[model samples]
Target: MKVLEAYDLVKVYRRRKVVDMVDLKVTEGKIVGLLGPNGAGKTT
Candidate 1:
């Protein structure tokens, strides 16, 4: 089962894009983590 799904995710700040064209999927009972340094767009 899919717990979360996303497609074509885009995030922009000012004229620059923080995140672009990201596809993500999380199924049931799955563990997911975003690892990145500060300002690496991990939250974007």
Candidate 2:
């Protein structure tokens, strides 16, 4: 079954498009991790 879904998710910062038209999905009963560089929008 579907657990989490993010459609057309967009985030802009400092007049710059950080996350543009992002689509993400996560299933149930699972551990998810968001891995990225130090400034790769991880803490944006």
Candidate 3:
């Protein structure tokens, strides 16, 4: 089973591309961690 999914997710800031065409998917009872450096769109 799929819990969360994102397709073609794009986020830009100040005319600059931040998250470009990102796709994600998560299954049931799955624990996923997002890790990234600062300014890496970790909170986007």
User: In order, what lDDT does every prediction score?
Assistant: 0.84, 0.82, 0.87
The candidate 1 region of ten consecutive residues with least summed lDDT is: 35-44
**Each candidate's TM vs. the true structure?**
0.74, 0.64, 0.70
Q: TM-score: which candidate is best?
A: 1
Give the higher-lDDT candidate: 2 or 3.
Answer: 3
- lDDT top scorer: 3
Query: For candidate 1, lDDT tens digit of each residue in 1-44?
Result: 99899999898866768778989999999999988678767765
Q: What's the ranking of the predictions by lDDT, best on top?
A: 3, 1, 2
Superior candidate under lDDT, 1 versus 2? 1
Evaluation by TM-score, superior candidate among 2 and 3: 3
lDDT for residue 11 in candidate 1, whole number 0-100? 85
Off by over 4 Å in 2: none
* lDDT (tens digit, per residue) of candidate 2 on 1-44: 67999999998877778788989988888888888666667678
Task: Give candidate 3's whole-model lDDT.
Answer: 0.87
